[model samples]
Target: MSPEMTRKIFLYGAGGHAKVILELLEVNERRCAGIYDEYGAATQLLGYPVSGNLNDDYKAADSAMIIAVGNNAVRRKLARKLSANWATVIHPSANISSRCTIGNGTVVMAGVSVNSEVRIGDHVIINTNCSVDHDCVLANYVHISPNVALAGNVQVGEGTHVGIGATIIQGIKIGKWATIGAGSVIIRDVPDYAVVVGNPGRILRMNEPEDVAGK
Candidate 1:
């Protein structure tokens, strides 16, 4: 597909986040093929019908999909099970630099700023108003929550979840499957599967196997 043209989108989750993505599609002037909820949570979302079974749903050959759920591990897991064209959704209000490289199936929400040489991987979420400064690297399935800020050259490993209002200083390396708590200030490196919280960001506990993978 051409860079200027957008394929019809099929959303995987019909929850509150899907509501925002729906509006984002509107702003982009792209059509939604359908909405899907694996748990059958709702019959419809904002007038869009929700498919009860993803396997049985009618899909367009040219359509693309965006996993609209918020959980990092859940998105990663579901992404592995489904095979289709991936859609990268970016809000029109976002300020992404020309030098930045974003991967497929990533969703960059409104008011976000991604600076020069930043590399964001597949199925990542740079949520509302987040700022990823120069040379930051976000691995696949990472979630940088609303209002989070990452200074220059910070490296977030795969499936890491940086909670709302968190701040990570420059040159920090956050490991895979790590969770940085809300409002925390991360001054140092975070290890894999560790859950950190508080002002200076101390490790609260190591997440159980199920915590990171949702097993």
Candidate 2:
């Protein structure tokens, strides 16, 4: 469909990430119906009304929604609770190849470069200034933070978060829910729930139940 025909969207968060998503929607000429943030008491956000909590029924039948939360797990959980009418917002400045397949509820932010044959799954966030190389596979709810670089053939599993400025070498397979720390250089495969850090990325620890409790 033409950019002019983009549908109205409702955002599920009202913080900093939602603000960026709002700008993305604006660049594409899409309108936001409102925002839903359970913790926020503000009556409006970026000129749009702050609606009720996310669980409150969405009134507009034609409107789509996106989980604007930056946390990968929260976004994934919220997405599962909502209807299938999810919006994919791509900033006008992003360079996404026509050969790439982007799934619903994904957001491609400004200055991002997605190369040919990349497969981005549902509710993924390809954050600002990131570069995803050809043939990369990003599974559902993955968040590639700002300036992260993934070489060709890299595979990132569901709910993984590659922190800002991290670089993943070619053909590396990052397992589900892994966290690659900011500025780390990933040269090897990572297992599920592993948290890696440092210039040459090393597994710091697995994400245990206690670790999640602290967050």
Candidate 3:
């Protein structure tokens, strides 16, 4: 097997997102040692054994891991609990420009298109079928949900969650810990911790500081 294919990696989720990530790993020919989930009841996932609880010591220091949880807050919490080397999983079907920089622990899902000079931060999730245009900057722990479209030069701050089918206009800046509701079309700058919705993307509410404290 090729060197890249021979690398063993562990996954820290067993839900739908994990299943998709597992498929990505398989298609890339990387070996998945097992899956870990704190709440898992089943003994297996997608034919791979569900090894044990998420907190259990696996003792595979050489192996890397990816946080496959879809919830941005939960994923961020889980990321801090582990000190293992993180793995970046990119689906082969995704078209990513060579000029783009993806940080460690990021996952680029199937059918996603990331254009040139985009800077994606650590532990970020660029979910299925999303299109990120050139020069977009996504901060750490950000989650761009499925079918989201980010126009060129858009800046998404840390821990922000861009909901599914949301579209941001070019040069818009979404603030930290904000939430863009599903199907919203952003045409203006969003303030920190704001929850925005609707076609033109109006602010519905501001997420309190206490709500985003730990995450």
Which numbered prediction scores highest in TM-score against the true structure?
1
Report, for all candidates in order, the number of backbone clashes: 0, 0, 0
Clash count (model 1, backbone only): 0
- lDDT tens digits by residue: candidate 2, 131-153: 99999999998999999999999
Give candidate 1 misplaced runs (Cα > 4 Å): 1-4, 55-59
Predicted structure with the largest lDDT when compared to the true one: 1
RMSD in Å for all candidates: 1.7, 2.5, 1.9
Q: After superposition, which runs of candidate 3 have C-alpha atoms over 4 Å from their true positions? A: 1-5, 54-61, 213-215
Q: Where does candidate 2 clash, by residue pair?
A: none
Better of 1 and 2 by TM-score: 1
TM-score, structure 2 vs. true: 0.92
Per-residue lDDT for 1-215 in model 3, tens only? 65445657889888888888899898888889878877778678889888555643434655778888877777778778788778888999999999999998899999999999999999999999999999999998999999999999999998899999999999999999999999999999999999999989999999986666363
Error of 3 at 123 (Å): 1.0
**Residue 201 lDDT in candidate 2:** 96
Q: lDDT tens string, model 1, 1-215?
A: 57435577899998888998999898888888898897967999999889877863324566889999988889988889887788998999999999999999999999999999999999998999999999999999999999999999999999999999999999999999999999999999999999999999999999876878766
TM-score of 3: 0.92
For each candidate in the order shown, give its overall lDDT on alpha carbons: 0.91, 0.87, 0.88
